[model samples]
Target: MRIFDPHIHMTSRTTDDYAAMAAHGVRALVEPAFWLGQPRTSVGSFVDYFDSLVGWEPFRASQFGIRHHCTIALNPKEANDPRCREVLDILPRYLAKDGVVAVGEVGYDSMTPEEDDVFAAQLELAERFELPVLVHTPHRDKAKGTTRTLEVVRESGLDPSMVVVDHLNELTVGEVADSGCWRGFSIYPDTKMDPDRMVAILTEYGTERVLVNSAADWGKSDPLRTYATGQAMLAAGFSADDVDQVLWRNPVAFYGQSGRLELEGADADEGATFEGNSILRGARAS
Candidate 1:
């Protein structure tokens, strides 16, 4: 039962977390650049953040034998900061870098004007790079946020197949799926959708182009959510195939489309290295 976590925030996680996930069958993971728990004060911070996404984090995952990939973006929550826009401008250079599978986790947050501007710009960048996008709907005013996200995606003229609208609840699931894009549900602790509810949604909708992620980060989140969600499905009488499609196949189909994520020999060293005197510091590449 090889699993692929299509979305996670490994930068804020520890090596122990990766070991547990890999032990439970998380063979690969795709992380998205998101709002750090604390606000970053400068463009340099973002550059360092991006560096970690492609460099340090992947190395950390390899220590546990998991393949790591990422989605590059300016998180919608930070889009409103004028200073953050400076970091957004340079995102293009990194989007095409190795290990970035999608331009994502970008969409509405509070539905502000800055979110709109940044979202629109990133969509254009996705178009230019011919890359897929992973959109994050607002936690509040979600129905409206999902609707606007659909509209903006359509306006961007990106093929609907290339878009994944994430963090859907009951209200937005139908609309998001009906919009001809991939739909994602985050099984979080007390705030986002529950595992039992996620099972119910699968029973009702019969999972097609849908994805599930922990959306775990520097907050109250369960690191083993993808594994737990699979267990819930099994307890509900879902076949191994059913769980595989939802947690493994679906995400692999999505990320593999980018041709970035690759599987090395199980014995190959996938660790990452940092230059001496560099601001980056973490596990060294072996």
Candidate 2:
């Protein structure tokens, strides 16, 4: 039952989250750069965020026996701010860091021109670095946004194989699949697809080129929604292997291209601590 959560925001989660995910068989995770719960006011903020993704975060996950990797990008929601361009300029540096698996969480929110600029720029960064791109389709008006996201990928001249269009639902899953890129679903508690609906999508698409994530972040989303989706698949009579492939194999195959994932031996301790620091420091051992 080894699993990989291909999209999570560990920077917004707790150390207990890492332990819980590992206890539930999440052997690895990939956290994409995202808009902070509060807006970032400076480029230094983005730098610290990127450092946490590759540095303290991975060290923390190891304590829970979960391998950690990440996607680095400017989130679409933040792209509109004129200040955001400064952060975008620095993405190439972060994308090249160890444990950065892709350029992502990048795509449209309001379909604004700024979103396009950031999205397109990151796509070029992905290409420039020969990395994969993880896209965050708009939460609202997903059907329109998903198509537009595909179009942007086409216009950027990036390989479709190096793109993953995430946060999809039934409305856009077909188009996303037909576009010859990986399709990702975020099984959230309220805003995104529920477990029952996620199971139906897998049944409809047969899981060949699809992926599922929690998209867990500062929102009221469950960090283990992907695991819950697997339970739903079991209740629906899907074979264990079928469930495993969609939830784990596809994401690993996708992110492993970045050359960052690592495994923890069974004997690994996964529990260590640092002095004078809390989860706020994000550097606690294991």
Give the best candidate by lDDT: 1
Q: Can you give the TM-score per candidate against the true fold? A: 0.91, 0.90
How many Å off is the CA of 272 in candidate 2? 24
lDDT of 1: 0.83
**Sliding window of 10 residues with minimal summed lDDT for model 1:** 277-286
Off by over 4 Å in 1: 264-286
- Which residue pairs come into collision in candidate 1? 272-285
lDDT of 2 at 266: 28
Q: Please give the CA lDDT of all the candidate structures.
A: 0.83, 0.81
Candidate 2, residue 13: CA error in Å? 1.2
Best by TM-score: 1
Enumerate clash totals for all models, in the order shown: 1, 3
